[model samples]
Target: MNATAKQPISMNISALPGATTREMLADQPMRMTISKLNFWYGPKQTLFDVTLGFAANHITAMIGPSGCGKSTLLRTLNRMYEAVSNARLEGEIQLDGQSILTQDVTQLRRRVGMVFQRPNPFPKSIFDNVAYGPRINGHNQPLAEVVESSLRRAALWEEVKDQLHKSAYELSGGQQQRLCIARALAVEPEVLLLDEPCSALDPISTAKIEELLVQLKELCTIVTVTHNMQQAARVSDFTAFLLTGVMVEYNPTPQLFTTPSDPRTEAYITGRFG
Candidate 1:
């Protein structure tokens, strides 16, 4: 049985049209906020005390080298870590002012959807793949309409409109990735978490996905973990740098990439060290 969730609430994050600064953080309204977060895989800690705020209706990118705890931190936002045995976290992750740790897992999953590092489309028809999540969540909208809307939002409807009944695998790798995104969007999630969504796609596909992500923030908050600094700069409004399980710096994408306040952030961004 799905646990009962209160009516969906809206958040109020303070943000300027194009401003990204630490001093502005205090006034920013947030879609999700993390404070004093730590995570462990049994006795092995992967994240230290990390704190940050994700502005509502914005794309915040988490950039770091491999094993830097970026993925672990992203998973915690939706409580995805709970599925792993002995994986534990100590922290407060709030969605629209509600603590996600205390949220009903099913309801939270519905509101906060995820796209994996690789495109993992189901071995189903294109239409079926996009319709799956809405069906599982008992979305009231017409199923066909939901599928079309999701595909369009992912910027894939035009390419596959005539082949909705075809197998998802028959599409190119980029289409499969967009299909996965369409699947996630069908559920009408309020926040979307993406981890290296474009790492495997071609440059053209990567650009399309980046464009889609930028458009998506107008309707939902996005938190993505990417190793591509250029992608981060191209698509994100805010960027947070992580290092060895701790937050090195959190700033607007431009500030972090152009004039990082911390030397560690500069070193990593400049290729001095990973």
Candidate 2:
């Protein structure tokens, strides 16, 4: 792809009045879909009847105020919520038109990799950290090649190439985050879910990660939960706004940021309230 060429918008899902989620995605090629998803932690419902589609090879960002269900919804995509005691979900989630709920949990995770808010690199060497997933999944690919390819994809290979055997902890915060990303990419997931992946990094690190994400979208779909609206606008092709567990608006990134259809979305983005 030409670096200067604009990416063709696959769907015209602007934030138009009365537009339904199904209508928004009707013509797009979706890598994942969520239908009437309702989730709860014990008796407190956190998500309510949310429906959305993630376009293949595109980045979709979920943005909202604190305590909104952005992270909760992201977790549902890979069944990460299963770790929370008393957590339960109702509704259907599909990847490539197949119900993900019925798939093996282990396999589902492999196909839908996740990175959390903080960079939680393993205590082992940098090389071993990126190689962990492939080893555990029994991938027979050459480990050295996979490590190099994954690091290169994450935009960290050049920085860490000579220090492959160094502990992941030795890297700066930004490098560690990119290393975590390399670990996720090693498995060759079809969808990558990130929850505030840049929250802890400095501006330069954040920019590198943002650039890496743009490049990675050519290989996989990406759904990220970010509190920073600017980051969402800079990196995502689509943006979804959630308020108090309800989907307020979802549209192409430019439209949602500039001319939001919902008053709540407008207020939040304009800094009137969160």
Candidate 3:
């Protein structure tokens, strides 16, 4: 977003011990990398020396107890914390080898889109909701095509195809959430951040969202914060467990869930304690 000239930042995840492993990343490139990130709200710190890498075209799940800074860490990727008074961050966050901190907030958000926990559709027509981002970003593509493509990707096009002109509020809870996802995708972001996206949905709705996420990995990288361990296991390729602002364990989802290296991770995942 910032038009200022700057140097590209190279991220060597392998050099940062415990940040990520070659086995965990496999052949996937790093889509976004956070190194030694620290954040605070005024004087109260929320995240401490957190380092992780989100693999390209993969779903990385952040799982932890309430107030453990899962959402706090996710917000840092797109610098969403800037809106909070007295919030501060210290670290380097790179998106495709570029520092997002130096980019314009508006443009950074466009490249790194987000969807909140609850379904938040606009007070406009279904078509208008999906078209909003592109229209604001001055996209040259035809609005109808973009809307259709986004909705299809979110897996809501067929159901809403006949109701494009209807108000978004008229849709079901799950449908509205998918619509929000469609709105985010309309901008064609490289990284999609979701904060407990399916937490408020029913089982069926949650399943749809999960399926959509898997399909979406082909288009963009996904980082999600979820309290549902089953959801994390079902959807994510990599999982990071956080406890009281510290990242306890980060590894491939299968390995982390089955044989976590850290005691805290095992305890939390096994329901011994949150």
Candidate 4:
């Protein structure tokens, strides 16, 4: 298929009321639908009745205060919370209309790749780092090609092409984060979860990662949990605000930043309160 310029998101809030609480800026397809989601760790609940939908080929950012359960909700989507003992999940999370909880864990994980805040590259060479996923998943593609394409998609190939054989640890922090992204992309997942992927990097590195995310959305849906409000404003198409384990508001990025429906959202965005 030929790639044409995608239509720009409508940011015109001129006539719309300032308190536009409704979501669905456009008739975009849903990549994931989360309904009445509740999560608990042993005895305490971290997420309460969080229901939202992530649009395909777009970036949906989860932003809120430190303990607002942004990461908790992100992890719940992929069932990453299952690792904790006594962890429990309630309600439904569907990918492409099929329940994620019902899917095979390995297969589900392959289709829902994730990159964490810290860059956790393997101790092996860069080539091995990117190839690990495909190798484990029995991907039939040529290892060299997969490695190259994934790195190029991540905006890291040109920087690390000559050093593919070098230890992943030898690269700088930013490069390592990009490498982790390349590693995640190697499996060709349909949805990517990024939990503070840029939190540890310098401004230049963060910018690069943000740029890569925008590019990656052409191939996959993106759900990112970011503490940086400015980062959300710059890169996300949709924004979800959580406060005290409750979903306060979810809307288009422009709407959420400019005229949030809830006063709490406005206050949080404007630095009045977290």
Candidate 5:
């Protein structure tokens, strides 16, 4: 999720007071760091003790074959895994510097927002869809400004500027996905997690979202899960290749694609095997 304009540095923890502790530091004024992380759905493990760090103001793409746990790892970043009936997680995900797994999940969700593969806009007007997160989070700003700002950040403002009251479903697939991004941006999360967000869109729509991702990275740390190899190369500064729920390699995008040290990463990127 992207920030509006540029938030004042004064709003930092200095104003919140006593947020100087290690727990508060984990909340991240900047980046997200995951260490020795693992996850499982019931008795079946989906993630290994993965360790990775997503730099602030950059996009890190997670790439792998289906069920390699890319999406599962994305969910764990924000504790979406906790909602499932038998899901469990081990290890820590530190945002900025704080361990989110041990913190209040409700609070964690506010700091980490996610956009899914498919556009799942609410059955509401376009304006309301963008306004939903703020409304739910008890934001009392002037509704018009918040809606406009969020939509602009999502790169959907020009298209929907005239149809704020139209039902969200009225928008095309790409527009709907952008609306979802706007909805997530409404809450001003410190980190934005996208799970194959362009998979359901057309090429044109995918291009638009990719452009939006580049812009959004300027305002928040971004972690995206994608099956598109070109996209990983095009949009990400760093890329991590996973296989069977294990991280094979992680490095700068150029290096990872052109000179991967791990044979598995090279094979996957070169269209050999996933």
Candidate 6:
């Protein structure tokens, strides 16, 4: 959706270590937990000692102002902060009761996929775009099966089924976003993290992604960061509100939106201020 066409993803070696190993991650259980977590970039602390739990097979949305650290916290969950040279973290983040900080980072990411704000498909053919993750992780299965199943899971198979070999650039912006989702799903991640996934799409495309998210929660835990209250209310089972790098409130989506306990949350949701 951005002006630039999708570019081939570059390998992020820094985010690869401390993750579960290839073999171990494939066998991980369903639970994912975050405990007493704190994060900082050099001297700038972003997250406080935040502790929270996400249920298996549910959708959790993180909402807050632009600089409230929602995205920072999401990146920390999957060790995306590792990519930054001066980033520092304290406390434990676990997937299935296993501390992710102690696991092989690459494996952790493979088990936990992320979709960014913009639709960023690879420059390659559509099939290759979805297949990239599995190929990089050394999946030996037949390529056709991998691509088809992944596309189906991402809810993009039918739309792109006939154009599998075409360059991802040719697809509509919405299709490219779904293709990105398919690329993440290809590896069969246990948890999917979406950061403002619908920010770049039009209203119709945004609705499609929301519908797909509901379907995705049946298979994996989903944690999304969004600035849109309507989108969070529409898709998430739970919602967490952050401000100035602190979690002000976290509750079931219905309660958070309709009867938030914190006055700040109420004001933010009521359009007083972000």
- Give the candidate number with the greatest TM-score: 3
Q: Which stretches of candidate 2 lie over 4 Å from their true place?
A: 1-26
RMSD of candidate 2 to the truth, in angstroms, is: 7.6
TM-score each candidate: 0.91, 0.92, 0.93, 0.91, 0.88, 0.88
lDDT (Cα, tens digit) per residue for candidate 6, span 1-274: 1212112111121232242332222233337777677788999877776766676888989999899889999998889989999999998888888899988999999999999999998889999998899899988889889999989987888888999999999998888999999999989999999999999999999999999999998889999999999999999887888877777776668877987767889999999997
Better of 4 and 6 by lDDT: 4
Which of the predicted structures, 1 or 5, would earn the higher lDDT when compared with the native? 1
> What's the C-alpha lDDT at position 98 in model 2?
96
Per-residue lDDT of candidate 1, residues 1-274 (tens digit):
0121111111222432345375565466888899888789999888777888888889999999998899999999888898899998887889999998887899999999999998999989999999999888897889999999999999999999999999999999888999999999999899999989999999999998999999999879999999999999999988988877877778878888998877778889999887
**Compared with the true structure, what per-residue lDDT tens digits does model 4 show for residues 5-97?**
111121222333444344254456889988888788888877777778888999999999998889999998788988888999998999999
- Give the deviation of candidate 6 from the true structure as CA RMSD: 10.7
Question: Residue 172's C-alpha lDDT in candidate 5?
Answer: 99
Q: In candidate 6, residue 195 scores what lDDT?
A: 93
- Using TM-score as the measure, name the better of candidate 3 and candidate 4: 3
Cα deviation of 179, candidate 6, in Å: 0.4
Clashes of each: 4, 0, 1, 0, 4, 10
Q: Candidate 5 residues 101-185, lDDT tens each?
A: 7898888999999999999999999999988888878887888899999999999999999989999999999999999999999
Weakest 10 consecutive residues of candidate 6 by summed lDDT: 1-10
| Candidate with the larger lDDT of 2 and 5 | 2
Give candidates' CA RMSD values in order. 7.5, 7.6, 6.5, 8.2, 10.2, 10.7
Candidate 4: minimum summed lDDT over ten consecutive residues — where? 1-10
Candidate 4 global CA lDDT score: 0.88
lDDT minimum window of 10 residues, candidate 3 = 1-10
Candidate order, lDDT descending = 3, 2, 4, 1, 5, 6
Candidate 1's error at 263, in angstroms? 0.7
Q: What would the per-residue lDDT of candidate 3 be over residues 1-274, giving only the tens digit for each residue?
A: 1222111121354643453443556546889999888889998888877888999999999999999899999999999999898999999999999999999999999999999999999999999999999999999889999999999999999999998999999999999999999999999999999999998999999999999999999999999999999999999999988887878777889888987877778999999987
